[model samples]
Target: MPEQTPERTGQPVPEPTSNQVPRLVVTWLVVTVPLAYGLFQTIKSVVPLFTG
Candidate 1:
């Protein structure tokens, strides 16, 4: 077997490659967009409490 590199030594790994870029982006957007929207809506709803 090939020797383990620094990535396998409990360190931060390298960045993904071109083939993985789109998938990573889609995954992040799918997960983050709704979460960010929810957070925004929560903040929007709570703003009135502080202002009024």
Candidate 2:
């Protein structure tokens, strides 16, 4: 038998489960927070160079 695709099966594409939300949020924060901090620190350091 051929494997059924969701289209053929007439099923909707599955959404991310509620259980995944927190994990995704944590993962996003983990990546973005450090990036944000680095960006902020870079801007802070660079501003002093321009202002002085």
Candidate 3:
């Protein structure tokens, strides 16, 4: 068991369950998919400008 500090109460931190794992994956994909697409499009546009 973990110890509690003065600022925090004696309550132990709750561990994530099995269902939360997929939620984390979905959350990351939601954030990362658009980020990856934007990066790809930006690089593609920049490459043409540099070459031409």
Candidate 4:
């Protein structure tokens, strides 16, 4: 396990660094893109049920 710093022990978590931005973006896209595609497919399939 990692050692804790005295300052960090009692403090709130620090803000994400600039280096983390790409990782954050990629993570969000990885989750959201598949979610969006699933929603689109569901809607597309359900529309025919209603229309017919």
Candidate 5:
């Protein structure tokens, strides 16, 4: 076996700073909101067909 570096072994992961958290949260919310809305609309549309 060869010696391992941080990149090779994927150890010692870099931690995100406080500023990064909000950006990530905002990004996730922006993407997920649209996806969730689309899913909700699809389910609503399908449910009417099944019920009728």
Candidate 6:
């Protein structure tokens, strides 16, 4: 069987280090960019009838 380390000792896993921030930022941008674009398009479609 493979050895289990401190993870198997029941301790909580440590938080990611500073080096991981860029990766997380990139992931967030990838998800949010398309989401924001879709929301903007939806609002644009809905707003014209109210204004006109």
Q: In terms of lDDT, which candidate is strongest? A: 2
lDDT of candidate 5 over 1-52, digit per residue (tens): 8778677898895765977989999999999999999999999989978899
Maximum-TM-score candidate: 1
Model 3: residues with Cα > 4 Å off, grouped in runs: 1-16
Candidate 5: TM-score?
0.61
Candidate 4 per-residue C-alpha lDDT over 1-52 given as tens digits, one digit per residue, 9 for 90 to 100: 7679656588776666997999999999999999999999999999988899
Candidate 2 least-lDDT 10 residues:
7-16
Q: Write the per-residue lDDT of candidate 3 for residues 1-52, one digit (tens) a residue.
A: 7556543895676765988999999999999999999999999989978899
What's model 2's overall lDDT? 0.92
Collision count for each candidate, in order: 0, 0, 0, 0, 0, 0
lDDT by residue for model 6 (7-49), tens? 9877787777986899999999999999999999999999989
Per-model CA lDDT versus the true structure: 0.90, 0.92, 0.87, 0.89, 0.90, 0.90
RMSD after CA superposition, every candidate: 7.1, 6.0, 6.3, 6.7, 7.6, 5.9
Q: How close is candidate 6 to the true structure, as a TM-score?
A: 0.62
Candidate 4 has a TM-score of 0.60
C-alpha RMSD between model 3 and the true structure: 6.3
Model 4 / residue 42 / CA error / Å:
0.4
Clashing pairs in 2: none
- Cα lDDT for residue 24, candidate 5: 96
Residue 24, candidate 4: alpha-carbon lDDT: 94
